[model samples]
Target: MNRGRQIGISVSAAVLSGLLVYGVYLLQLRQIRLTETAEVVVPRQFVPAGTALEREMLTTLRLPSGAVTAEMITEMSEAAGLEASAPLGGGEPLLRWKLDKFRLLPRRGEATFQVPRDYVKSVSSGIRAGDRAIVYLSADGLASRRLFDEPVIVAAVKTAANQEIDNPKSSNLLSMAEGDKERMYASRRDANGSIDAVNLNLTEAQWLALDNACKDGAAKLVIAYDAASFGGEGETGS
Candidate 1:
């Protein structure tokens, strides 16, 4: 009888131990479920392709921790991201916490060119998309020459042909007033054709300067770089 009682107690203890272990596992799972993490989907504009997910980048992304929702993620762009975060009334801790919230992926932005149409047509006629241009803006005229005197280099074209010039077309002299066409023909008669305006990408300051200069008079477009990457100032005029 005593032996049977001892066996029963041992069985009961084993069952109790198993129950305790199961309970501990369930508690651990609950804790895990309650724990939070940050998740975000940054917009294409805010995040550039191949941008390193460094702490500096993170400082820009303000995110809250724990089971982050989609709304919360969208807000993340507005939160810690550069533009949004800039105005947000927050401290460093909030900024740092937000940075710790997300990851970055590949994205692209449009490369826009603001070249004059005439230049675009001129360069497009002679140059292919990937061609380089030694872009020259018209310098102010001196007493001896017309206000549109010499061309000055403003910027070097950085993008490939596919990305550089946009919507190139030839200017029609026939469409001009009879007198205007005659004058244009006479001026261009010494040249290959009428000089067309072209578009170019430049910094904010460069754009402002170029705009002011062009407003004063016509700007010249010369094909400085070609297939063989040849020709500029020293070469015979194209």
Candidate 2:
């Protein structure tokens, strides 16, 4: 073929290829716009862990139906009165996993008590709100004995400075699994070590037991990740 014919053929091929690519792009854009959407609950402001979800704390957001996951909180009622299991940023979708376990609220004669700063610090970093832990009592500062016959669920982990030890640099101890060490280190840091208190969901009888233990001696809280790990004293199972 002549050079002119060759050049014309190449130009035609280039134009056709461009049109095909542009056509595919438009098709994708159209499909995205056609996707279904659903109203979902998301945080309107920063929601701290252990805080009860209030109406003002959340708002509805219309999101693509495909983006919804099984863990997401679809209804406002499901999130209402539920405590956050972890810190949630503003505009973040509310998820069931982010909230503490749904349990009956404190009843008459029952109260939410704050665990002492020292006691909170003593517990492993793996412990969080909704975890079951056993409280121990130390009479002479020499040893601690288990005070509770069974574990009680940790209602909330509160800090005096409103911050958990979440920064890696702030953590001085390392006992978590290799997979969790990096995350545990990333916990919020407190320069004053003011990650102070933890709330315990205790019944009247349990509260009285703790009070009696405190009166008799110092109380130390321990979280056992496994029941079999509690064979020895002073050994905490993370």
Candidate 3:
């Protein structure tokens, strides 16, 4: 019985020693420095707020995993074409929150398109994101045609500060003002919400249709809100 106990103990020690050796081998094979590094997408240059990121603006860097954060962008593809929600420094690791995705990448069959403010004529009612937009296009600067057969979904409405408008409690802040800082900021947010850039989710065909019309340098877009609790007054005419 004593001999058996000794043998069992020796076997257990040998297994543990083998496991430790194997673990060490794995660590050596993986190379701690290489295994500890994570690939993160970073800005190549200082990017201003509201600027749309292009492929040229981004680069990948191998940073220590310990330095990587949950919010840091890992894929360069993920950062391209996204609107910078805030200013980015040169060579700084790009964080996800710095880019607003609410107006980017839509459903599988649809694409999100942002209308430049320069193509707009006037905005009448207040607009917010998540509402559908009734779009019209004037290609000849004389005649206006419906841009889409249906009211497309507005993906996002960004303020001049490049901040995407969130679902606030209400846009009509005057009647409900509590005279607090939150109220003031809310009112300001609604005021600055968006009269300029409106992102819309459009079908691929619809996008091509808009593109074809605008190719002549004659097209301008106008947006009207469908009758709903959400409303905004914006016109599309070049």
Cα RMSD, each candidate: 15.7, 10.5, 12.4
Per-residue lDDT of model 3, residues 1-238, tens digit only: 9999999999999999999999999989768766688899888988776566889878899888878999998987878877676889988999877776434435446777876676654443444564556778865547677878888767777778877655355443332223243553344344545454677778789888876766556776777766442323232322
Query: Please, what are the lDDT tens digits per residue for candidate 2 over residues 92-204?
Result: 88887777543323423456777655543256544444345676665555676777787666555545666543333643223222324334334422323433566777778
What TM-scores do the predictions have?
0.33, 0.39, 0.42
Backbone clashes in each candidate structure, one number apiece? 23, 8, 5
Residue-by-residue lDDT tens digits, candidate 1, 1-238: 9999999999999999999999999999887766644545443334433222323444433345544554443343444422231222322222333332111111122223456544331342333232234544433353222222222221222233423222223222221223343333332233233324334334455456545655545554333333232222112234
> Which candidate gets the maximum TM-score versus the true structure?
3
Off by over 4 Å in 2: 1-110, 118-121, 141-143, 164-194, 216-238
Better of 1 and 2 by TM-score: 2
Candidate 2: deviation at residue 206, Å?
0.8
Candidate 1, which segments miss by more than 4 Å at Cα? 1-6, 25-113, 120-135, 138-205, 215-217, 221-238
Clashing pairs in 3: 124-233, 125-233, 221-236, 222-235, 222-236
| Model 3 alpha-carbon drift over 4 Å, by segment | 1-105, 139-141, 166-190, 229-238
